[model samples]
Target: MSSERKKPDIQYVNTDTKELVNLLIQGYESIANKRLYPADPLRLFILWVADIMVQQRVLIDYSAKQNIPRFAEGKYLDNLVEFLNNTIKRLPPQAATTRIRYTLSTKRETATVIPKGSRSTVDGKIFFETTKDLVIPIGETAGDIEAVCTVVGEIGNGFLPGQISKIVDFVPYLEKIENLTATAGGADTESDDSLYSRYREALSTYSTAGPEGAYRFYAKTANASIADVKTVSPTPGVAEIRVLMKDGRLPEEETIKAIEKLLSAEDIRPLTDKVVVKAADKVGYKIDISYYGFKHGQLSAEGIEKAAKFAVEKYKAWQSEKMGRDINPSKLNQMLMEEGIKRVEIRQPQFKEVSDTAVAIAESANLINGGVEDE
Candidate 1:
């Protein structure tokens, strides 16, 4: 996009409390022919008006930028985000989910009700609730009962393996049933930048032979969290497709099947080509950093650590899994330096590059202050 097409930064300065108070006092003094001190009673009303006006301007500016930032507040923002997601053929990310499977006891002969909105607990976090009613017949068990139950809150719902051992609320005869292993989906709705980026990709590419421009359209089908996609023909008329999921986990069988089905259709893939789909391999990274220097004028220990960690987080997000990507340690060190840290050494990722068939992801980061060692 050209500079003219981009949203320019709005720079209107909203009046602060002091400015509002001074302006009002000046007008009052001009009309009454007397100066009033800051202790005047009417000043409170001025301050109140000032605060409300400032808040109004803030909301106005935020709403105006919805076309750019894509972050919304309250109900309007929620609907906008949802609309964008639906346009992209994926459901909005749900909170943490756990296995809330149901099974009829061997002796129980009748159908049992696993009522809707039933609640489960994973200690140290919020409770998870079922979305719908589940009917378990005789011989029905865990995964067969239903998809996993999700937590009421999104923050603690991810990566909870076998955590829902206790039941907080359920319909009668719950003790006779079994709750199988629940897994966490661990995803957030695609960000505004990600959505915008994908749109640009779609506009730019077409699925032509060798160039493989149109694979993005197929990769983004329902339930597919495409991190990266690569197509290769190991043999004539056979396109070997490897899909890397966004969260670095293997794509579900249904998602894989969907890709195969979509690719097989004559409208998308060539009629003569045989397409095979598979998930990419995940390679985990743990980065340990040793850096020297204070965060821009920050002298305190905690503040320094927080500022430095923030810079590392920005790097991590930009570097997270994309296919055919390599770990650039020099870029990471430079990024930290830009945040006012120097003399850096990246300890993890001893390898120079991650293969095209593999997706590189980091599990954890270890940032050490290194304490002003010789630079």
Candidate 2:
């Protein structure tokens, strides 16, 4: 998702109050067959009517814009997607999940059963519950089961192993419980920009033949966390889909599997097509720059330094948010200049071209502020 494309903002009808008032005055003069001065009661009545007409015109323009996919929002966008229910639908918020390990106090004589829906949490604010029961076979000390967050969205993500160790549910003979893997795959509901992008691609899906756009659209629909998708046909009958998660994170194995299964469906993919889904590779880069502020500028040296540091962080985020974005030192310098810096000297990260199947990530940043200098 690149939102670089410009969307049209059209004014379907003029709602200028002054223009509407003039038009109403002209109509009144022609219908009454007499001149109407500004002081006349009839003229005042015409002004009031014009105000109402202007409001109606505004409503008309708003309604027309809502019908357009580029301009639609919220419920209006939902309605537009409903029109293509057969082909695509809006995605809901997804909960984060992680594998939890359950250990017994001792090697049990018989099987130890951890019931489904067992709850565990690091804090009471967020909870994770097992999706299925875990059975430690006879003489086994432990078993692993998958657990999902009780809440949806990104709030439940980023819990490292052992972060969630407290067990809320009582299981007889259970000694300890911990997360075996990091929590991931949580995402918010689909955004308006994302929905519009899919709508444009869905137009190409009417044909059974798998075009690049159609494949990309289906891949995006598989997961809400996906930020960008690149579809290519390396061979005659093979389609490869490369996925990039939001904030430059790679998609987990579960996310890749979900996309693979969705694309491999008999109705979704052509019988001759072999679909492969994988995460986009990352290309590492380092940001090393020194900047100075103008000596005679309004701000103090401390203020300028703070602004420069914030700009560097913003640049790093911009660089990693999109796939195939080249590592451009010129862009970094420009961002610093716009923040009231007098000059910038970039040392590392000379311009590098990133492939469509890869994204550039800034592994480390070295920002040196050289105090103030003459303009």
Candidate 3:
């Protein structure tokens, strides 16, 4: 083995270093107080505690040594800076340097570059890359525009840092804030009742016609119209339309035409109603209509079971659309089980029960001699 001497590890003064460490901790606290703590309060607390612990360890190690290390001195500071730089260099590129990448297109390239330093020192001053583009394209949504403004503001403030930037890259931080608040507050799609109420109010406000009149006019003319009626797989052409009407008869030419006219004119689309008539010619004339209706004389005891299954599926879709929410699977299963039990009970024939002589005899025996003891 080679007899090469190893380098001596640097040591420090425990007491003085502790005091300096405390000062640094206080400084960090002050910085946090002024600049705002991290969004994750737990993470911020953990970081503070960890930093303090590390400092305490350093102080303890330094104080135990014969000669104390000078941390505040220029030479020590330079060494510390070099160590930090070395550590940073050793880290992954993703950990060390941050990059902001975006396609430079006519639609996207409108980034505002704020020059670093004042006008007096513009020549030699280093320019930092700050502020991403915010292009409010024509006919963008209010929320979209709001989100864009938020992203621009964040980028301008140099808040887009490394991995964090990846998350806040396309989407705005403010939008995330809004979403978090919305989620916490349980804000979702509007309810059917609310939609109905709003529509009713709107229809009622129309001049020369009440809500009822409007509804009738729409239902008869525009709302009722259907187009592109076709025979679905495993279903004949005639039965498809008949099942939708629930009248057990094929739709007439007049009926098809009426449905087409109503749908086209009123712009009413009934998602629930599967039966549809498509326009074949000009003036919105409907020809063939398709539906997922039950076949004639096909439903029996077995067929009823199949129909029940279909009903459950249909009910789920209906509830989801109307309530703007989905039913919990566990709750649905329990409900279905209870309903099945109730249905079975309902099917059972009721009969009057005669008094059992044997039970009466047993009760009488129990009453005698303070309830008979077993042998």
Clashes of each: 5, 0, 17
Residues 84-115, model 3: lDDT tens digits: 33311111111011123322223322332222
Superposition-based RMSD of candidate 1 using all C-alpha atoms, in angstroms: 7.3
Candidate 1 clash pair list: 96-157, 99-182, 206-213, 206-214, 207-214
Q: Which candidate do you rate higher for TM-score, 1 or 3?
A: 1
lDDT of 1 by residue, 200-312 (tens): 44542355433454565555543324566777777998987888665455665545676788777776777678888888767777888887774344446665576678887
Show where candidate 1 strays beyond 4 Å: 1-99, 103-106, 109-143, 148-161, 168-173, 176-190, 203-211, 221-227, 231-278, 294-303, 346-348, 363-368, 373-375
- Backbone clash tally (model 2): 0
Q: What lDDT would candidate 3 get against the real structure?
A: 0.28
TM-score of each: 0.59, 0.85, 0.16
lDDT of 2 by residue, 1-375 (tens): 246326555899998999888888888789989899979999999888888888999999999988877777888988977775546677889999899999988997899889899999988789999998888999999999999999999788888899999989989998999998888878899888788888888876786538888888888887788889998888989998899888788887767887999989887899999999988889999988889999999879888988898888878888888788999888888888888888999998899999988899889989888888888
Cand. 1 Cα-lDDT? 0.60
Evaluate model 1: give its TM-score: 0.59
Clashes of 1: 5
